[model samples]
Target: MRLAPGADLPVEVLERPDFPVNRGALCGKGRSAPALLARDVRLTGPLLRDRPGGPLRSAGWPEALDRVAAGLARVRAEHGPDAVGVFGGGGLTNEKAYLLGKFARVVLGTANIDYNGRFCMSSAAAAHRRAFGLDRGLPFPLADVPHTGCLILVGGNPAETMPPAIRYLRELRENGGKLIVVDPRRTRTAELADLHLQPRPGGDLALALGLLHLVIADGLVDQAFVAERTSGFERAREAAMAHWPDRVERITGVPAHRLREAAGLFGRAATGMVLTARGPEQQSKGTDTVGAWIDLCLATGKAGRPYSGYGCLTGQGNGQGGREHGQKADQLPGYRSIEDPAAREHVAAVWGVPAGSLPGPGKSAYELLDGLGRPGGVRALLLAGSNPAVSAPNAGHVTERLRALDLLVVADLVLSETARLADVVLPVTQWAEETGTTTNLEGRVILRRRAVDPPEGVRSELWVLRELAARLGVPDGFPADGFPVEAERVFDELRRASAGGDADYAGIDYARIAAEDGVFWPCPAPDHPGTPRLFLDRFATPDGRARFAAVTHRPAGEEPDAAYPLYLTTGRVLAQYQSGAQTRRVAELNSAAPGPYVELHPRLAARLGIADGEPVAVTSRRGRAVAPARVTEAIRPDTVFMPFHWAGAGRANSLTNPALDPVSRMPEFKLCAVRVEPLRSQQAGAEPAGADAGAQSAGSDTVGVDAAGSQPPGADAAGSEQAREETAA
Candidate 1:
């Protein structure tokens, strides 16, 4: 970040010129970071609603903290500790993420705790861990991308999502490397590929299997590497052989010749890599689908080699770190399993708590949200750094679950969609005004320096957690060092808890991170240099061999039927960040990508008599949403794409399916069955569906961002009036 000395706001947010990943480039989201600090919509202090369905009002720190503590205590006393749920986000710093987990278990002693990161890349993480006994977004850094001979990008559009990283793809092609892109649409990233395979939605598993079959048939399998460094290949091979090119073509809608061609390109290359994003990872069969992709890498000798492996393109800030720390549902600090007794002992010791006192893994993100306010489910929830109301799959249902909660506490920088519905909202400090550590996609731990002071009355998450813990009646100061409010103090304890663990951050300190420009993880000792490239000589498995998954293609949880004859896929746009909690409030960003629109194939649009920019109603089994049509040949004929960054009328997630991967517990957010109908009589607000989500003032604030897709007669206008009356009251 380039800021004038002592200035309240940054002059320009520039990428580090020497950084290996971004390499002197900044994406629109990165550059717009300053706009968040300047926004008037930022929540300056705590807000409380004393009763159900009551309007929130300002409260002092003491009163608000007391109310939150009392509510949580009431829930625990009435329904037991398990009823108090703690929800976190991927955007939180590692300290905050770790502290949140500690707060849930050590303070409140609840098992019902999870975070939004589960929605981002849980499937990929599961597959990676299953294959290599460890889960890192990328074993090799982004710097290895340009050097690889061939790159198969599955379900990722980094050109739009991560503009700065596109240079690697461009350089790969310039250096004569082949790029094969697999997606249901010919996205901007796909346009750059040497071969673009537009498969059917949720057909990525079949596509990967087809590619693997061809690799073996063409004698491209690395027999020597597989025999020496892998296990379970025979079963995986059998599964792939069953998925012949012709059979795979039938399922994925890709021609056999193209599958063979894509296979040949990857197989012929001396080095190769496969990277998947939400399109493949956010599915009911996402774990198996990702396993299929990893199987391809293993078959082609891509694992445990330089510039070759399977990686996940994580979509959230601190995504790698958030999951590695204690925030995830099933993990302890340093990515240790919560079910592991030894891991429990170590983390408990660090937290100064009895090992037996720690709670077991509760539920994944969607399950926790889905269980809200139900019998024997979570009654009071403390959510921080996430806006599941807009981001969750089957969002309409999730939003209502949130509303049903007896106590909803949200800590955020702005009045986010989830915050607006919060019974008690605590204004929290954001990135620029908070100092902490974040692990980037490459497993690099970087120290975040506070550039400026936060506005008065705004507290840091560290302070919030400490105060809450105190109010919850911790005898000692708490968490070893009394839950010190300083980030450095908390980090020192994190280093201890992470020692000798999978992600091993003991060697990494604030000093080391700053001096090294960010240190990669598995730095087990202070003298040991961080492992930038993992699994070079040996994989992390018990026998020093990567495991190949024996998996086969399965149909999506919900396939297109007569009632819902089309596939609905959701993704990110260039100008908006996840859930659009902060990005949508930025005027420049909102102007660039102001509204959500359904991207449909030209033929599909014509068949439905829907012109470009015409409002189209997309109805699914769960709900319905209305958005403008973007008719183009870029998308598949049987599929429609919606960017899941908006709310209200165009809230795409409302129509997404909640069918979850059994292993990863990740919802099928990317694909669901839906029907498109051209709207002729309905008209919602014209200022896009986003402005209504977190609007501050009443009457003028657009309303009716429903948990249900289709509203009743005059519900939209009536919602607006109700919002006005509430704000006035």
Candidate 2:
């Protein structure tokens, strides 16, 4: 139940059931989504620049499209297909995402096309594919979470990060189910856990190995299941036994007694599920760590049951769907391997392109950004719905290279930090003013319907890309005579591409979507109901058996030392979203978390003579930033937490290290050594007075510390230092 545009209503009245609910009810953040659609700063028309520093003058759609086509053609002709890379984002609609891959493979003849999802979820995807022969969220539906005897949460902070999923956790708790949480920080989710194991940062693999060691040593492993349903168990067991409780304790900082207790409880449970997030997947050895986590569930025979399996809690809005539809660097639609000849042939037949038209797999996100500004590197970049300046690891280097690009194109609803630097800014429609489908963490597909018209000049990404294709004279482009006019057509194309594959969605149609609020994938035919679980009897592999990956613990690429004695981990706050492009503009949300601040242990702060809300300059080997201190017990004494939303004054990315995993190539955004110092008297007088004043200054401007030592104003300094000090000590 949603109200039409211009329907005046009070907040309290809208909250009542008597008044119409907005699209089956919205969360606090969802309720404010309508305001994002009403922003006037949207880029409606395209603009072109004659020179690098020239002003961007508005041009007709045809002119803008022609210029883009000509520029791309020239780059390809002069350098090569690899010279022009396509960097996509996870926020695009399913249709747009599908087309982005298609455009890169068929039209550009370049395999150098990858989405931002590579940076966010590639490690989890790679690990799951290696272990389970499948990469969907969980084997069972999200509804089954509440029925489990025990739930093991690793790395993730679902209590604050994923509010929608919290309902199931609450239901499970009400039903007397046990919750076990493992993280370096005692996050909001940890507070709700019956048992919480605070492991050291980048020590997740060691903890997982220790749990497996205890399971096997105590004779808790399911021998029958391992013998019949898994491979390589003997080797995995050997690896697990190599890391005893004492060794794990030394590496992970978790007491050997506590780990054994948690292991006993988990091994004895009749049914259990394991969930992991960035804490496990944002490391230099992320893939190996995730593999160890999956191995634990398999060893205990917890997968493929009603409420049991290993799950990766994805971060992006459409992270699952984006990877499924060939937006990844080495994947075709349907989770098919890009290097597999048969899979490539099948996709080529459906797309009506030459078998060899698709270029070879491209470089990962870290490599692409690192290559920028180097010899034979990317001269231009087209950013779709991403703010690399604030989100990318080693952001100082990324920002420097971004400024060196010959051309930069950014497409988004608002002027994000990345967009503010674009040579051409294209205004796009927001979610509330568009219609499509998005696959959530549980693999449930839901409709994204438009309740109001887009603001003046704003157009759907589909419309913008289609116009560009026509201008570029792309062969057999979608009908140019008129607009697609319907979102269902694009979904149908995705359905065709995904048929008979791991992420099959052929059964779901627009009519079914309208009739039902949502449906899960593997909906392979019109009459078939969606599948809620997968691999119940036989695995998806040729042998119908799950593989046991032998995993080992490895230290993070960067470790704390004498100069930088604390590990800095990056994450999101409850009140802010990624990069805060839209949420920061909301007065209420902004007031809740106005700016960035470092969360440190009170003991660490006291040692450095830093008070709560004091300004502290946090510097890594790669870069540095100055943020307000937040001494709290949420983190360990030798560890710190910082949000990655802010940019100018104290962006987390600036202090992040960019060392990547060899397998997944995901940057180590979670663990990096940093030195924190109280800003001196000279630095304390350099800050501007207000938010607007600070933002107006460049990223290099001096930021003064307040009396309490926090950023001058607009900085978040909630909670007390005593709690942090006591917890750390």
Candidate 3:
């Protein structure tokens, strides 16, 4: 095969005799992944500075690991384990992600370790685990999406976000499946919907409850299925009654008649499924909102079927895997709660660590950030893979506290925004330059083969962390042997960790992955074929019955008022990935979405005296930012949308409210109160103005925004800082 410019040469390019060359399909992003790997500026060394916010100087492996180990030891010894927090990113390999959680609990003896998965999918996870006795991602393959008779998409924009999933949706639509989209904005996905219910932000629960209420009140619910397969139905039904379509219409802005029609269509369908994404989860009431959606599925008898289930479209590539590997604050491997004695004991026995050594559930992302800069709070942080500076909620407060940390260590492939604030920066290998396994959205485990050697001086995160473990004198009993080594060893550890769990993969090994493109989990042995779907008959619950959780509607932490009358919703643009650390560097990707721009309804833009390409200021209680406004009817009049991937002058997080869900602890990234106004020429000029052109001059150094609206030099630094603040909080 011919190589792209600067492409890393693979060890061998053997031709497959049986399979055709074009057998496998590639999405747009996947096709671009190879070119991205060839880009310059990949990090390849360890760096350290003498003081906080000081210049970074290159250091050897030994020196870098020693400094990191010594600093962690010092913090633990002086301020206790809680003083040191570890933040993880979802982009990490399964092996590295697993070790990160184990290192925090055992090596540092700190409970304060959580990954960006919390912000991406925890509420959906919590809801699924509660209702189905398991969280099996989509519960079915993407192929099944088109077979369903009815598809209800809530709080997601799969058409813009997940293009492959959108293809399946389109196929389903073409094959007679009705598509109903529920969201505050009339997103691109909504444009294709048979019906689009524009709910008010944070009103997802009310909408869901209203659906269930209609299904129950009109006798459209499946009584036989509910009675035999579920418990707690009466309580959920009672709660739903209070949120009838008429009442919910007032709260959600979705018309009463439309709500009733949508509910009836979904309830009467032979196979119906409801899907959600980051939109519903990144709110103060995210968990309950998710629970309400689950209730609808249970009431309508839509779950556990081949073409039906409650789906939370995971955001990160490995968000589902991160949760399964115990990167959450309160979880061990296999979705076991850390607080559960039995679960804790099971994991401890597997890892050869005492149960007492594993701390209970710790502070969540929001709480950790709130504690930063406070007396006796987190003094140091170790960040990996995640860029939080431009992504985390309440960007203004997080920035202030981030500069106050005593020690900050960031491990990443580039100088991301958060990494710029680091006391030490460890260069790490990129995805194409490393070998490992990653679980996709449908729980399919695919191998990530190394196409080329890592850049000079750059090391895999596994190698760096293993060296640190040795220097720190962590007991050899920990799975350190798998470090700085082959991907097979890491896969072995993962298999062992998942033994006897719902996501068991002990039977499959490295050899099988090489021969087969991928396999779903629960392949307990070599001869056992992988299970494509989960929960075919009964749930994992003891009684073999799914439970209907009672959920209540709650308002967002902040509401629209005279000062900030517009509701601000944050999301992604087609060209930029989350945080825009890597993709923004690609010229073609950045060219499509050059900089931050507020998406407004034409009506709202007219009211606010704003126009396309005109500068506008969007202000919230937490902070404010200015960006060019694109007036279109894609969104509702009362709501405005902005991509959170951009930082610096138009950082969306800066204007996002920091109110967190009580259960998920995820910030309200989806909904916040803001006021938008046309930016005067003088005001626009007074601000540090260049989309990407002058991004390197001032605060742009922190978020990595270059002068041309591309990722700035140290945007990875901002990512590291954001990760630290979110974890330490």
Candidate 4:
């Protein structure tokens, strides 16, 4: 991005012509990024509270740092190191994510570390490993999307989330490729599809099984590839055969004929691809759901070829890198499993520590939050780069958990909702003033060059970590060069730690990143160029063959019942980003999507006696959310949609279920059961459905809004008084 001179902030964010991903193009979020750098909307100093639930006041960096370090150390002393939890974010640079995990395990001696990426694509990652023996968002560069013969786009709406990617879809259609969209709503991306399959929410597994059944029934299965390059197909085929077209039609809302057409369209194409996103990956059965999709790709021989495969369209900017370089609960750098003795030994040798010293895997995102301040749970927590108060599933309960913490420390550019509850809030540097690297969805590692110096009171997360480490008694780091305050130094250590692991980055340096625009992972040596397309000749498994998951359809965590008769699904809008911690602060974006509104089909709205623009309460077993009604036929009559970006009365996550996927540990955010009722009292200027974040200047002490009614949903009395007394001791 080119910066313009003479301006207080770098307002001119020029799209680089040299970038291959979006050749001279950017999405609305990219265009409006500068608004976040505005002085009023950003935090420029440290904030501290002397007591829990006390007001946050401005404090010098030293005092704020001391309070955070002391508070955390105190909790660890009384309750053990595992009592301190570190929560990372998907948007953090690879350097920060790596160090965040390292600090948790090494400096704090805690195994309780995880990230928000758990909410993004952990399901797909789990399935990828199950089938291909490795996990990378996309094994091939996104440039191949335009050359495929057919694309089955499942659960993702690139038109809104990643607008620049639409170019490739248009090119594919222009080249005579068919596009099939699978979603519960006819989204903008669905409008461009050759065939749109509007299934009921959480019915993707059934739809995929039905499609595979048709492929087998129509003799579209590639017998050659199946015989030579795949295993366990017999079991998978048996599972698919049980869900015949008629049975699948009963389970999912798609017609039997439409299933046949979709199968034929995808199977007849010489080369095909299936790309899934959060919609199918955020369910309690997400791993099995993705496995079903992959099974279809394998059945039609749509994988391990130049323009064919199953890939995940990752939601966050650095989600791929974040998961790879150690922030995930079960992984170390290079996507190595934490439980593997060999993997732990290698990473331990690199960190100059004993392999046995490293702690075991911790709780997943929701599980960790759910246990906060409870019996034998985390007592002190450190969170960075994420706003879980407005993002996590069952958010009202998550908020209460945050409030019950003995000490909460948050690092961010602005006062996000989560930061408001912190005992200490540290103002961190923004992207333009921070030099770091991020791996994109395609597994390409790219350099993010700093364009300007940070304003006087702001500091980089690297420096903050180093300072905290020093206070915790690990000043010079294990290797003597450890705990360094520079991004490049942290990255250098990360490379060595990830040397021979699956997502190897030993050969990728910052210089190489800038010289090549970006470098794909597994660049094991300096002279090695990179692997642009993987599994072209062989899979990453020991036997060099892809394995099939014998998965079958299952009900969502909470199916729509008589009490909660409608399915509530959540997603993004063109004008907002996740949780709206940053995007909602922008005036232009908020004007486009002023506040939260419930999107329901006209059929459902009419039955509920609700009109367009009327206020309605979306209630579930967890909590209730009131929002303006947007009655349209674009969505399925059985499903209601809401954007989770907003807070206050319209907070969608307040009504979501927190059921965790057994394998991926992903919370069921995409599908849940709910009931909607008209809120006549709140319809006309009687406290709008949501907070106008753009108009409200955020302060560290501000709770943002009356978040979830009188008390946060599921706000139980925390640990017994004896537990608190023990912590105080």
Candidate 5:
């Protein structure tokens, strides 16, 4: 919270002790959030473009809303509602996420709706559902970390991404608990670990399999627990038996002895846990990789017990809540499957709509973006809170698709990379200017209170949605009592819609949240206090037994080839967030990390004839990105690292692979293959910077190779309005 002496004076931000999750701890990003409230950097009015490739000019709210509504409505009328896709962000409050899903399903009648959270935790969610029949980042509270006897932190760097959360790890060490960190780099969190295993990028599956193999060979498996509380251990153990420690060592670049030591520490602990993050959850085989880790927990009797389980560290602020609601393509409110009849009826009844009116499941996030501007695909898109142009895999191609859209509407607080290419930009309020609820990584629902008023021209997304719905001839779709934008009113509706589903919150309300500071979900009734820890006695599955998945290690989608010889991995810097849309605006954060740079081992830099701080052109099969070389011994000699926060030539995602995970549909953002060269001449400097090279020869009309190594069709002009309308009728 901040206190101001006067309207024109500066404000002071103080940590709130009342916030149960953070516990009066604020990270660098949280501390610098106040700087984003500056009126100059914030978008205060709507901007509209007359046509594609036309100039954008300021417009009144009515004209802007009318243009957006009419554009989307026209597309819906011509090609059916499925022709218009709705894309959302993980940062949206639970109210906005719920309403966005409702707007897409009820008003727009489109199933092509998903959010950026697909990239954040879809793999973990998928694995959790497969084993426990439910997904929450942490089944137990974060406070349990210190009490656990052994903690294995896999592919997450909380020291930079979540500073407040790092306290738990430190406390674990102080309490005589062992900390084993697995990452490619010696991150700040890894430095505090008793054992740090630096595996090759995208090799987490192999590493986990080796650990399980060693555990089983050493007789560390809990036969009693596996026989009573789990199924399919024999199959999982059989799969692990083939992956010996030496074979995994060859694949992961980790020593066999180190693997055995780490496995022994975790398997022998009284209370052990394994936690994963984006590093393992953003691969082409992310779902199976996560399943492998969960199998280890199940075999060792670590899961479904106090202070021990497999969990994911969610990236975005409200990522867990955002995905639980209807924003995800395959999900309805309360984390219910969109294909389930009972789930559909429950949510539809709350919205006063027929269950049959809901569209079937559509494409996932990356698939939706890839389908833009193609024939028989979505022609118009409505995006909110995400900047895929910079954060998405194969970002150069994503930017091209945005340019190809007939109508691109973006709602954001700033002119982000994605917003810059929008046909209409809707200025929206920020966190301090609105009151809403968000679910943290631990499934704790916390209230975010408004501390100040938004600028005059800015409005909430709820208001924008309500006004747009009325303009689209669904004036009664949004309720009058809270349609124009009230957070608590929307939350009340959410509670009812989530009554009996996987993420039940029927008993939770605004007043209860305020009084309790924060409450865990599955509060089915007001008389029932919120569940702080789950699966203490039984799993959420129908038979109350966890399932083990038989998974194996596989090469990444894009492996090092003769042409693209070195591996490229992308991540975040301490001072920046996912896309740097808001963090870059803060002068303090900008000063800490001014731009992107390519980090490579000194030997690799020497082989390429590139010195520290020299310009390097990194070319992948999909695109190219240019950044200054940063020679460091911390990284592997065969790999290069870059932070994916900046836009344009420095954007690391420009050269990333868009290989989709088979089940999760998450793009392989963690690792890809690229060739690097030191800049030599002016002609080389003038080459197309960060330009996407489609997987086709010049003048060829064939489909290009997508992230999954499959050839998809080339872009085609959308159907004519008259032709589309005939099909619709």
Candidate 6:
């Protein structure tokens, strides 16, 4: 890697190719990271808005911290400790995650603390624990994909979303392994597959059951393996049997022949794997959807063996490790349940507090945000590493709730849409400017070294937490000098805190990780080598057996109806990352992906009188957003795809459903019912259409094709109420 002085600051050049996993292959996002270092869009110092509708003024650190402390203290004094809520992001380092949890509980004494990671992999996490008694995303490394005989990728598009990972899939094909893809869109990844099964949106559960039924009917089940290493086969078999070929074909758009083909390839392989991503795991029934796929692997004897298993393609920088530690509502450090007395005691001792001092688990991500400003709800919120105002489901309504808060503090590198609405915004360090540890999809913990100094007025999250703690009457608890800002110091304490938990990292340190490329978790002793692959000899269950979930197919929480006849599915584009707070600012990335667009089949666009690059409006029961039409045959005709990376009228999340999965509490972001309308040429820019742009200048809140086509009276209000009611439950 080389660094050269560029426009605003020194830029990072090409990366070292000797690194494993990515192997020096920088995706658009990776290569463009230096682009995010621009000074113009960055929050160089703290900005404070003294009054609700007042212009934010730059302030010194002391003044800003004082105001934030006073505001939070006032809320805590008026309402209660829980009134001051804490929201984190999945991009936070392990040290930051652990410390953020500590600050919320030990300092603020609040139970309201959670992160955006809940929306990423909670469904798969729930399913993994239910069957294998643990969750680690992937049990094997990317290196193993080439050795497998077959790879079934469900609801994932890694070619565009994760470029480096596509190498493994390509290598799998090179080694004579077959690739089967299940998604509504024929993504770049699907184009590389030997077989692509484009099932209807929210129909993944049915498709998995159909494949399992074919596997069982063809006598492809590993009878001996199922009998010896697994249990509950009869119940799972009965559930899968109920989903016959004809019935499954009716529910999912996939044909019977395609199901049989996918089943044959997976079952006949000597060593195979099933990998799932957000596509099938962001619905109300996402747990069961993932469980069905896991059951197929278990029944076919593909799991718990070398080069054969089920895995999840975790998105986000540190999504895998973020959930493993304390930022989650229900989890303590090391993936331990906060409700468990033993787990609480262990963590409490590590934090130098009594077990009883710890608060019980709080609400999940969406629930936490939805409760803001409601009766008996949180009042003051401290946000870090997350921008839910644009990334959350039913985002328009979420933005409204955020505005209703008494005080909202945001810590980020840039002035994201969420930060625009904050009472105070604090500039913080990011990727190359900070040193931390992130566990990748393969569960390998690697260190990210700092390459450049953050601009003036910028600070690390650790420093901010220490300062806030002192101001909040915890000066003794967190002495500025004692509370370390160095990443290694924080990780040292984290190692002790995670000693005996499930995702243990006690014996692993910065030195060891750097020396070995990376080390896998559950590395308890100093001399003990990290476990690269799990479930080789026995499952994690008490009986050393994997349990099969008796899951059945179910419809999405919000299905297409007469009023909203087309299915709306949201995802990522090649040129942008999640939320687009950082990526959208990069000139190169923005030039390629300038704004959000509606991707619908040419037939659907033709029927709606929409042309490629023409403006179109997509409306759901909750809200509406307008973007340019991208007519293509790669996606299903009945579904419309939009990337949730932009804000204002181009924000796809504005029209997304917020129906939560009962088990994982993950909102149904993958699929929702929506109606598409072609906008007149003269009315193309009637609504906002770019990143960070404001809503319709017409000042009317409703979004529709024309003035006469506005939403029915009370519709927007009713939808907002319904969303709040659902989230409250």
Leading candidate by lDDT: 4
User: lDDT by residue for model 5 over 1-729, one digit each (tens)?
Assistant: 352211222555666776656679988788878776766556767777765665555667999998999999999998988999999999999999999999999989999999999989999999999999889999989989999999999989999999988989999999999999999988889899999998889899999999999999999999999999999998999899989999999999999999999999999999989999999999999999999999989988999899999999999999999999989999999998999999999999999999999988989999999889888778999999999988888887887787788899999987676776788889898888888999998898988887677777788998898898888777865645542247787888999999999899999987898898878998898988998888988999999999999998899998998988888988988999998888876767877887788999999988888999998877887777777899988888988999988775677888888899999999999999888888663243344443632211111121123344532110111112112212221
Q: Note the Cα lDDT for every prediction shown.
A: 0.84, 0.74, 0.76, 0.85, 0.84, 0.84
TM-score of each: 0.93, 0.90, 0.91, 0.93, 0.93, 0.93
In the range 1-729, model 3's lDDT, one tens digit per residue, is: 545434555333433343321135444555555554553545556666765534565667788788888998898888998898988988888877887888888777788888788888878877787888888678887778889989888888877777656777888899999999988888789899999988878888889899889988888888888998889999988888889777898998889999888988899999988888987888888888888888888888888778988888889888878778777888887667788888788878877789988888887876776676577777888989987777788776676666677788889877666777777778888776788888877787877677677656777777776677777787463444432354667668778877767777777676787677678886777788887777768877889899988877878899999978989999987777898777655556656777788899988888777779898877777766777898887788898888887656577888777787777788788999988888773353343222222122113323333234454333343345345323321
Query: Any runs in candidate 2 off by more than 4 Å, and if so which?
Result: 1-25, 47-50, 55-59, 479-486, 681-729
Cα lDDT tens digits for candidate 6, 232-289: 9999999999999989999998889888888999999999999999999999999999
| 1 or 4, greater by lDDT | 4
lDDT of 1 by residue, 678-727 (tens): 87743554322322332222112322222334432222323443343223
State candidate 6's TM-score.
0.93
lDDT, candidate 4, 485-559, per-residue tens: 378888888999999999999999999998999999989989998888999999999999999999999999999
Quote the positional error of residue 431 for candidate 2 in Å.
0.5
Of candidate 6, the 10-residue stretch with the lowest lDDT total is: 697-706
**Residue-level lDDT for 729 in candidate 3:** 18
Between candidates 1 and 3, the one scoring higher on TM-score is 1
- Candidate 6 lDDT at 462 equals 85
